[model samples]
Target: MKIKSAVFVKGVVGPDQILNDGKHKIAFIGRSNVGKSSVINSLLGKKGLVKSSSTPGKTKEVNFFLVNDKIYFVDLPGYGFAKISMQAREKLRNLILWYLTSPEIEHSRIVLIIDAKVGPTKLDQEMIDVLKDFGHDFVVIANKSDKLKRNSRINQLKIIREQTGKEVILYSSKTTEGKNDVFSKIFE
Candidate 1:
């Protein structure tokens, strides 16, 4: 289950034909600066495929990437702590909520990314609650695991697991740690 090919498809902000295109979608979501784009790029084994940024909230729309010509890897906007205006941030928040709760769209899986060193935050918990309420299958990815020391990494993973109530995979987009584990979970 390797990603042999990937290409950016299109970005949408509201209901559209792409939502019902019958392609299995794997959505990546998390708070701002959680490295969601970097994680997606790492999973695809491409550096610039997903357009990562140091600043948060760069992803303003629901960007879809066609992976292996079979499934769609949806890069959703980061939820919290963006430099954007209140109205813009609210729109992004609503867009994320709609995508997650919409009945017309079927997600094969959702990847909830959290900062490894920071653990899960308040917004992450809200997203988790929404996922639970909607009965969506999801996995937690603790990105930036490389930033933590060995003992800190263990403790952080434990804390994240306890908080998220889901197995948290320690991932490093820089070192590609846990890349195989992530791939298995995403493609399983």
Candidate 2:
């Protein structure tokens, strides 16, 4: 997709604050430091469009980015960061849940970003379960593919697919290998 105009919309903390204009929303979610922002930047064919950070829990609010003025690429806060307090984690979890299950959610599909090297964590599995419970099928992006060997990457992708029962795109934000694939699913 040729992104002629991709601009930051707004970051909201609650479901009620999500854009209610009836635009199709393709949301990105995962554990903290899983390269969610980087994946967004890669998909948009631009750098610094979504801020990438080394620290965990960099994104605290649900961010909305308007893409080509057609759909909204929602950048959600990541889960499962130990550095944050338990209260904060619970709040984030609740916010994520509300955004997923709430009827106001305009999400067409969610891109669940996972670390290619670390594979899916327990919390990641839990999120998958919640999505399934809501009858929402999501696309899984195994990010940071450049961190692992070719064989290991294949094995990890297989494992993730078997576990989630969903498509897992082999992705590297650094190389933008799976950038088009991600957008294809989103724009399909």
Candidate 3:
């Protein structure tokens, strides 16, 4: 889908009217610093649409962006390894869990971004389990794929696919690699 217009809708920390708006919601989630914002920007063909930062945990709330005036691309807070206090981290974690498990919100799709080179961590595994339990239709995106060598990339994708038991898309925000594939999946 061609993105003619995209704009920031709102950021919510908890339940809100926007969540029940009945728009097709596509949620983006990942570990801190996994380039969730970058992937969103690249996919939308907007460089600064989503705020990406050098420091991890820059996205504290569940931020929603309206894409094509039809769908809501939800940028959720990164789950792990943010340089924050234990209490703050727990709050963020709870917020994420609540959003994912909430019955009222019907997510059209959930994009789970992961570090291509690092593969899925223990936390990523936990998230996979949760998604399964909740019966959410989701996709695994291996971002930062430009950092991997060709041979290693193949092996890494295999490992990630095996671990997640889901088809893994090799993506690179820097090179726009796998952009069309991701776009099709997200909008499909």
Compute the lDDT of residue 14 as modeled in candidate 3.
80
TM-score of 2: 0.95
lDDT, candidate 3, at 100 = 98
Per-residue lDDT tens digits for candidate 2, residues 94-168, read: 888988898767778788998988888899999999988998878888999999887787799898888778888
Winner by TM-score between candidate 3 and candidate 2: 3
RMSD of 3: 0.9
Candidate 2 clash pair list: none
Off by over 4 Å in 1: none
Question: Which stretches in model 3 have alpha-carbon errors above 4 Å?
Answer: none
Whole-model lDDT values for every prediction: 0.91, 0.87, 0.92
Question: What are the per-residue Cα lDDT tens digits for candidate 1 across 31-136?
Answer: 9879988988888888898888988888888999999998999999999865789998899999999999999998999999999999999999999999999999
Deviation from native of the Cα of residue 73 in model 1, angstroms: 0.7
Q: Whose TM-score is greatest here?
A: 3
**lDDT (C-alpha) at residue 116 in model 1:** 96
Q: Estimate the lDDT of model 1.
A: 0.91
Q: Compare candidates 2 and 3 on lDDT and give the better one.
A: 3
